[model samples]
Target: MKRRDCLKAGLTLPLLPLVQKAAAATGPRPAAGLTRVRPGAAGWPGTSDWDQLSRAVGGRLSVPVSPFLGDAATRSEALAQLRNPFFIGDQPALTQTSGYHGAWLSRPSARVVSAANSADVAAAVNFARRHRLRLVVKGGGHSYHGTSCAPDSLLVWTRAMNQVELHDAFVAQGAAAGTAAQPAVSVGAGAMWIDAYNAVTTHGGRYVQGGGCTSVGVTGLVTGGGFGSFSKAFGTAAASLIEAEVVTADGRVRVVNADQEPDLFWALKGGCAGSFGVVTRMTLRTHALPDTFGGVSLKVRADSDESWHALVVETLRFCRDTLCNPHWGEQLRFGDERTLGVSMVFQGLSQDAAAAAWGPFVAWLAARPQYTLLDPLQALALPARHMWDADFFRRHAPHLIAEDTRPDAPRMRMLWKGDQSQVGWYLHGYASAWMPSGLLDDAQREAAATAICAAAAHMPVELHCNKGLFGAPADALAASRATATHPAVLDAFALALIGNAGGPAYAGSGGTVDEADAREGAARVQRAYQQLRTLLPAAPTYVSECDYFQRDWQQSFWGPNYPRLLAAKRRYDPEGLFVIHHGVGSEDWSADGFERRR
Candidate 1:
C-alpha cells in the first residue's frame, strides 16, 4: 500500500487496549488547564495512546534515546559522530548546536515521530494537540536559539522526509486564468539546502536562493527569513517561496500560497518557524544560472590602533563604492587582534573581473608599511553549476569541502570546511544587528568604521553583506518587503554579527564544558554587540540568528510586522499549540513554553 493509503488504513483500526484504558481513565477529552503535562504527570497519555499513534503513522514513532546514555565505547562513537552534521541530524536526541549557556540545553524529546510524509506529520500534530503535549519540530536541527529541541516534549522529526523534485513550469493554486508558469522546485521540509542545491543547481543547472551553509534545513531557513551567499542577487529564501503545504494546529492539511489562505502563506514566508504550523513541503521559484560563481579570501594585521582605524575606514569606502551591488556577498571580519579578514563570495563575475574589483584595496594595504599580509589574497572563479558539486570539489579543491566519511554515506553528503566548526558547537554568546545603509555615506562612514573597531576590541565582528538589501535590485527589495521579515533590512547595507562558541559540550557526552571561560566569552560578546548598538540604536536583527535572551524580540526581529504575524498565529493556532523561543505569540507562554502566562 502507498504510505498515504496505509495512514488511512491505520487510522481506521480499532483503538488499542492501552488507549481504551486511558480513555476510560481520563474521560473522552483532555482536561482544561493553563499548563502542559510532562512525563509521569496526571492526564499524560498512556502507552496505548502512543502505540495507537505509532500505528496510525505507520509505526514511525519511537522513544528517543540519547547517545550519551550508552556505555563508554558507545559514548566515544557518539562523540566522534558529532563532527558530522549528517550524523547529528540522523540522531533524534542531537542538534547541530549543543546549547547556549544559561539559556537552553539540547535535550531529547520524550518521544519522536520520524515522519516520512505529510500524513505522518498530521498524525503527530493531532496527537500532540489532543493530549495537550509540548510539541517540538526539528528538521535539520540547526536552530542556533535551541528552538528545535526541548525537554519533556513530543518531537516531529522530519529528517527522514527528505525528497527533492524539480518543476519546469509551476503556477500558484488559485492564480488568474492567464497567470504565467514559472520555473520552480518543490522541496520536502526535511531536506537541507545542499539537497536542493544538488538537484536545482548542480544537476538541473538552475539556482534557488537558500542558506549559505549547505546543511541548513530548507523549511526552517525559509520560515525564518533565509539569506544565502547570493542573496544580494536573488533576495531571501522566503521571498522565493511560491507555495507551502502546512499542517496547522487542528490537523487540517493546508496548501497555502499567495492566492489561498494568504495570511498563513505570508506568515510561512519569513514569519518564524514553528509559529504558524508545520510545513511538509515548499515550492520555491528558481532563477536562471549565472555563468560563474567565485570567492575572495585574505587576512591582514595592523601594527597600531591608528593603522587599524585607517584600515577599517578604507575598507568601508571600498565596500560602499565597489562591493555593495548584487555581485558581492558573504562576510568581512574585524578581529580583536587588529586584524582584517576578507572571506567573500561573488556571482556573475569572471576571475580577472573579480580580482580587478579588489585591486585598489589590495594595493592600499600593501602600500602601508604597518600593515602585514597574514594571508595572501586569493580571488578565484568557477563554473556556477559546479559551485555545489561535491565530486568536483573533492577532485580539485578537497580542502574547501568536508565529506561524510561513513562508508555508506552518499558521495554528495558534504559541507563547506568553514562550517565544520558549527556541527556540534556550544554557544557562549551570539548577537546581530543590521547596519543601516546610511553608515556607508561619506559623512557617517568614519563613525561606522569607529564602531566596528571599538566592537572588535572586545570580540570579533563579522559583517554579512547579503543579509541586508541595500544595493539589491528593485524586484528583490520589493519581494522582501512583501514578506514578514523586519523592514529595517530593506535599508541596511549589512548585518553585523558578534559571537563566540566552544567545542561540543552536550551534557553527558563526556565533553567538558569550561564554565569560567564560557562566562567570560559571553560577557565579551555582549559588550561587543553593545558597542555597535551604540552607533545604530534600536536596529533590528535576523530572527534565525539573534540574541537568545533578547528582551524586545518582537521589535528586534520583526519590527512592525509582529502584529500581523501574531494575528495570523491567533487565526491558525489560537490555543497556542505551536511555540518556539521568541516566535510569534511566544510571549503568552513561559520560558519553557509549558505554562500559560495567565
Candidate 2:
C-alpha cells in the first residue's frame, strides 16, 4: 500500500486491547480541561469549500468529509491519539509513510493537498488566506511537538515533490560569476538524506552532511540547522545552503539566497521549518568524496555502579580527544544503565592512520576488565557505506543495526530505522526530539552519570553523539556563524540526551498510554535534563527536532535571532498565515485545541 494509505489505515486501527474504552473515551475530560477539544460539525466550510482547495492544488486533496473530523473534531482526536494506541501500537508512531510526513501527527486539515509543484503550494496559500482557514504545511513532518499538523487547518503535504538534480557547473554569488563554485545538489521538499546521498554518490562524493538518519527529509533537516555525526568532518550541511525556492505567506513564489531576500534567506537556514515560508526546493553544497577507512563498533556492559563509574571516567577521557579531532567521524551511543558503546570511523585517512588515531581509545577500552567489547561493523578497511547494509544506518547509529541478518528490512522509526526488537519508545518517532545545551563537566558528568544510571536502570538509556555533533563549543560557533540557528547549538555538549522516561508500550488491557502519560513523560524528561540545561552557557535547541515544553523555547532555539525572526514573520506572514507552536511569533496566538483565534 502507499505510505499515506498505510497511515490512513492506522487511523481506524483497532484500539489496543487495553485502551479500547478509556483511551478512546470521548467528550470533555479533566486532562483536556486546560484546552477544550470540541468535535467538528458540518457548519463551517463544508464540501463545497473543500472542493475549492482541490481546484487550488496540482495534486491530491485528502478530505475526510465525516463531520467528526472534517471541520474541528480533530482537536480532540489529535489530543487523544497522542496518548494511547496511536503512538504505542505495533508501530510506536504514525511512522513516516510518505516523504512530507515523518510523523503521523497530521489530522484532517480542511484538506490535505499533496503539492506537486510550487504553483500548487501558492494556490493553497491563497485559498487559505482568502477564507481565513488555518494553513499548515507538512515538510518531512518530523517535529517532536508535531507542529506540522493542526486541527481545522489546511495541510499542504509536500511529500510528492520528490526530485533531485546536480549542478556541476553552477557558480555562487559574491564571487566572480566565472569563479569555480563548489559542486551543489538540489533536492525537492520531499527528498530524504538517503535519497540525496545516493544521488550525490552516484555522481561523485559518497558523503553529504544531510541528516543523522536515512529517511529524514532534506527540506526539514537543512532548514532547521542540521548536524550529522558523519558530517562533523564537513561542518553543518546548512552552511552549504546556497539557495531555495519558497512560497511565502503572501502567496508569492520567490527564490531566497544570499543575494535575494537575504533576511529571509538567513532566517531560513536555522530558524526552523514552517515559520517564514514553505520551500519547494533547496540547493546545498557537496564535498568531493573523501577517502575514509577503518570503522568499528565497540561496547561494554556497566552492570555495576563501579563498572558504570569506570565507563563514565573512560568516556570523559575518550571524548576529551574525540571532541578535538575535526576529521574523526565516529558514532557513540551511551548512558543506558548497563551499556556503553562507541562506533568509530576515521574519514580522510588510511587504515594505519585511522588505527593510530583510534588505537588508544580502542586499546584502553579493551584492556579494561569491566568492558566487554562487542564488534559488529568492526570492518577495519572500508568506508561506512561499504561496511554497513543500509546507507542510512551507516551515518546514523550503526551499532543499533542488527548484528545478525534479518528476514525483513528494519521497520522505520519516523525518519530513521531501528531493529524490530527496539521499534518502541526509543525509536526516533516514538520519543520526543530535544537538543539541549549543556556539558557534563567533571562535577556535572558525575551527577549526570548517577541520574542516567537510575533512569536507565531497566531500559536502554537512548543517547547519540559524534565527534562533531555538540562535541564542544567551537563546533557550534562555527555552525552558528553561518546561520541564525540556536545559540544553544554552541553550548550543548551533546547533540541530544533524551530524558529516560515512559516505556516501550502500555500492554494493559485498557490502560495504554494516555494524554496524562504524554504530559508526564515530557515533564519528567525535561526535569531530568533541567539540572544540566541550567548550567549551559547558552540556550541551544535544534529547530528540526523541537519541543515546546522547554523553558523559553523561542529564546533557547533561536537565541538573539528570535526577535529578528519574529519581525520577519510579521513582515511576511502578518496575518499569522503560518502558525506553529514554539515557532516564531507563535506567542501572539493562543490555542484551545482547535482553530487559531485572532
Candidate 3:
C-alpha cells in the first residue's frame, strides 16, 4: 500500500482523545527547566499513564525486547544476528555500532513507541513532554556516538515506518507558484539508503544522493551532512533535500521547506540530527543516472621509509593533477605498515577510461624497485542501474554482497561484504580533519606528504576524497555552502579520517570487551589524527563521524553556523525536548541530556 494511504488509514483510528487527555492532565505547562524523570521518579508516569500512551499510538507502545538479554539459545541467536544489519535494525534496542570506549554503550529505552506515522510520533512526543520523561529517537540505529539509545528513557522508534516512493516532478508543499518541479523521492524516516536506491535507481532509473553505507538511515544521513561514494559528482545528500515532514517538540506536525518555516528547513539540511525535531518523512531531489559506475583498487607495500615518503608525495601529486575532480571519489589509505592502499570509485567512466586515468600512477609505482605490489591493480565498471541491485550481485559477483539469510527477509536486502566488519564493531577512537586543497599545490605537496607519513607512523590514516568539496562542480559547492555544514569542507581536497575499533562487544551479547586494547588503540588513533591537525590546525569535522570527546565541537562541527543553529533550536524546541551529545544547544544541558544547566 502507498504511504499516504497508510497514513489515511491510521488517522481513522481513535487516537485523538488520548492525546487531548494527556495534554489536559498536564495542566499549565511547566517552565522549560529541570531534570527529566526516570522510572520510579516522583513525576514518572504510572501503569495507567503508560497504557494511555499505548492506546494513543494504536497499541504500538511496548517494552523494548533486547537481544542481548534472555537465555543461552537467545544469546546464540544474538551473536548470529549481529552479523546482519537488517536483523539488528529490527530490534528495538540494538544499534548498528555497539558503543565506543569511555563514551557510551548501547542500551534499550524503558519503552518504545514504534511509530508508523506522523500522528503516532506526535502522540509519543506529547506523552514524553507531558510526563517530563527523557526521550530518545531511533531509526536505522546506526549512531556511532551512541545517541539513539538511553537507559530508562522513552524511545520514538521509526523502524516500522520504512517506505520509499518516487516522483517524476515533485514540488515542495509551500513552493512558489512558478517554482519548477523536479524529480524527487519521498522516504520514510526509517527507510535505509538501500531502500531509496532500489526504488529510485534500480526500478525508476534515477539517482538520489545518499550515504555510502546502504544500511544508514536516510533522515540521519541528510541531517548530518551526508557523503556518498559519488559525492564529488553529486554533492552532499543534504544539498538535495527539497522538503521534510517533522514533528516538533510541541507535538505539532510541520511541513517545512524553503517557502515554509525556512529557518527550520535550512537547519534540517546538514544540521545535527535529533536536534531540531523528529523527522517523520523527507523528500530529496533526484538526478539523472550516469550510464556506468566503477571502482579502482590497488595495494602496495614500501620497502623503506624513504620509499614510502616518495610514494606519498607522488600519490598526492597524481591526485591533484588527475583524480581530484568529480569523476573520482572514495579513499586512499596510508598504513603504519609502510603500505599504500587505493579503493576509489568513479562515475560516467568506462573500464578503459578508468584504467587509463590511473595508468601514469601505476607505471610510476612499477618503476620504484623499493615498492612491492601487494595486490593486482584492478579497475572494474558496471551498469550504474545495477549498482545497488542485490540480484545482480548475487548472480554475477556473490562474494561482493551478503544477503539477509532469514526466510522472511526481502531478496534485495543485502549488505556489502566490505561493510560486514562494521556491523557491530565497537569504536576505540575516530577523528577526521579536512585537508585544505592548497595542501596539494606544488609548493605544499611535500609538506602534506610529510604530515601524512608522520600520521601513518602512529596508525593507518585514510583520506576520504569525496567528503571534501574542493574540486566539486560550482552548483554543488553553492548548494553545500547554503546548508549548515562547516565551510571548511568547501575548500578541502580530502578529509583525513583515522580510527581503530574492536570486534562486536555489546554488554550481554557474549562479546567480550578488551579494555586494555581499546585504551591503547584509542591513544594511537588520537596520535595519528593529531599529526594531520598539525598541518591544518583549524580544520572542521564532519559531525556524524567525529571524535567522541571533541572539545571544541561548536567550531569543529558547524563552525560559524552554530549560533544560527542554536537560534533555530531555541525557536522550535525551546524546552530542549530533543538533545544529543554535542548537538546544538546541548551545552545548556548535561552530557546525558537529562539535566538542564542554565
Candidate 4:
C-alpha cells in the first residue's frame, strides 16, 4: 500500500513529510516500518489485523477516517477533522484512553473509537458486547484518573455524539402547589455543561447545578454530582435531572427517571462513578432565567503567609457557616502564595443585593487593612471577556513576581483526588490537622505559596463549592448500594489530577531515583488524605483513576447498590458489554471482591 495509506492505517508516529510524500507521491513501497493492525474498521479491539483495521472501521463508520491513515499532512488533516467536525480545526489527537488531567503516560494497549452519533455509539457498544470487550467511556476526556480511557480495554469514545435539545415547559413550569413535575430538556450525553448553560439562558430559562468548569461534560458532572457557584441558588446538577436515556449492558436503551425506573434513576443520581449504565442522554428540568452576578474578588498577596492562611480559613468558615445557611453562592481560592481570592455569584439578582449579601466578608477584608482588595465585579474588563475576574488575577500574579525568584514554589503537577458525602463539615475537620504538618516550613511555605500563586496566575484553581451543594440526602446517596460491586459508593471520591502542561520532565534523571521520588510523593499525599478520612462521618472511599484494575472499585463507587447493579448487569449486559473501565461491570476487574450468592 502507499505510505499515505499506511499512515491512514494508524501509524501515529510523527514522520517526515518528504519521505511519505516521496513514497506516496511516487508509488507504494514494498515494506515500511509501520506495523499494520486492523482490530475492527473503527479501530476497536479484537476485529482485524492492525494493518487493515483502519480501512475496516473507516469503511464501516463512513467518515473521512482515511485522512487519519495517511502521511503527516494527511493524518494532520484527519486529526483536525476529529477535533470538531462541526467547526474547522477542532479535531484533537484522539488517543484511546490517554490525555486525562494528571496522566503522564498510558499503557501501550491504547486504541481509539470515535462516534458521530447515538447510532455509532450503539454500534460501538454492540461490537464490544459481541467481542466480550472491556470498555472505557470517553465524554470530555477531563477526568483526572482518565477513567473514560483505559489502558487495557476497548475505548468507546462519545465525544462525537454531541447534541442538545432544550425544553421550554421544564424551564417555565414550577413544582405544582399540590403535585406536579417540572418541564425538562433532553441533552445528548456528549454535550458540555457550558452548552447546556447557554441553551437554558437562550431559551429564557436557568439551571441550578454545580459545574465548576464550563468545559466539563454534563454527563460526567451531572451523574457524578456536579458542584459549582450556582449550586447554592439551585441544588446540584444531579438534583435537576428529571430523566435520562441510558444504554444498558445488554445493548438495550432505557429511560430512567424517578417515576420510571426508580431504582436505576436513584442509581444514576450520585450512584458513584458509573454503576447503572452508560448514559447516552439526559432529560433535565430547567429553571427560569435569572441575571447572574459574579466575578473574582482579589487582594491577597504572596509575601504574607500568616495573612494568607487567615484569609483562607476565614473564607472557608464564612462560606460553610454564614453563606451556605443563607443559600448564597461563594468560593474561596488560595494559590501558592500569600494570595487569597474569592468567586461569588448571585443568581437573578442585582449587584447591590449581592454586595449586601456579601457585606460581612467584604467589610472584614476592608477593615483588616492587611492586603489590597479589589472589586472583582469592577476589575473584570472586556476584550478578555473569556475569563472571569478571579481567573484574571491568577494569571497576572506570575508576571508580577520574577520567575527566577519564585524557586521555592514547586511547579509540580496538580491532581485532584476529592469526594463528596452527606458530611458537610468534612473539610473543616481535615484542614485543622493539615495546616500544621511539617510539609512546608515558614520559608518553604512562602516559596511554595508563591509557586502556587504563579501557577494560578495562569490557570486558576476553580473553587466550585460556591453553591454549598454538598450533603445531599445521606439516605439517597446511601441507597445506591444494592450489592457488593467492585467499587463501592461511600468510598468513591471522584479524583482527578490536574498536571501542569509543559512543566517538569525527568529526561536525564536516573530512572530508579525518579521513580522512588514519585512513590514518596504519592505516599505523602496518601497519608495526608488518610488523615482527612478521619473526618468523614463515615469512611467514605477515595476513587482514583488508576484504581480501575481493582475489583473493589465497583463497590467503592456503587456502595450498597452493587448487588442490584450486578443483577441488572446480568439482565442487560449478560456478556458484560458497555462497562466503564474503572466502573462496576468492568471486565478488567478480577472476581475477588464480588458478593457470592449463598
Each candidate's TM vs. the true structure?
0.94, 0.73, 0.94, 0.60
Please write out the lDDT profile of model 4 over residues 503-545, one tens digit for every residue: 1121111111244444443444344333333332122232322
lDDT of each: 0.86, 0.55, 0.85, 0.42
| Residues 1-598 of candidate 1: C-alpha lDDT, one tens digit per residue | 0000000000011223433343244323323347889999998999899899999999998888878777888778787777888888888988999999879888899999999999999999999999989999999999998898999999999988789999999998887689899999999989998899999999999999998888889999999998998899899889999999999999999999998999999999899759988999999999999999989888999999999999999989998999889999988889868998888899999999999999999999889899999998888899999999999998888988887877898888878888888888888899888888888889988998999999999998888888888899999999988999887888888888888888887778777679998999899988998898888767788898878988577777776677677767877887889989988878778889998773
- TM-score head-to-head 2 vs 3, winner: 3
Worst 10 residues of 3 by lDDT: 1-10
Instruction: Write down the worst ten-residue block by lDDT for model 2.
Output: 1-10
Task: Provide C-alpha RMSD values for all models, in order.
Answer: 9.6, 11.3, 8.6, 15.9
Q: Candidate 2 on 1-598: residue-level lDDT in tens?
A: 0011000000011222322232233222222212212226433456676677677663367753322222356434433333222132212113232111122232444466778999999988887777656777776555545566566667777776778888776564443456666678888987766567667763355556666455556887888777765544566667668888899988999888877778888888877658788999998877667665345555677557888766765675566555435555444455444777655555566767655666776777667777666552243554544322354454655654432122352332232223122222321222222323233456555655564555444333344444124443364357546687755444334444443322333121122344465555555555545443433323355655434455556655665566666656767776666777767756546641244433
Candidate 1 lDDT score relative to the true structure: 0.86
**Candidate 3 Cα deviation (angstroms), residue 459:** 0.8
Residue 468 displacement in candidate 4 (angstroms): 4.2
Model 3, residue 479: distance off in Å is 1.4
RMSD of 3: 8.6
- Please identify model 2 stretches exceeding 4 Å from their true place: 1-43, 46-49, 64-106, 172-180, 329-331, 344-346, 350-356, 365-463, 467-480, 491-493, 499-527, 531-539, 546-548, 592-598
Best by lDDT: 1
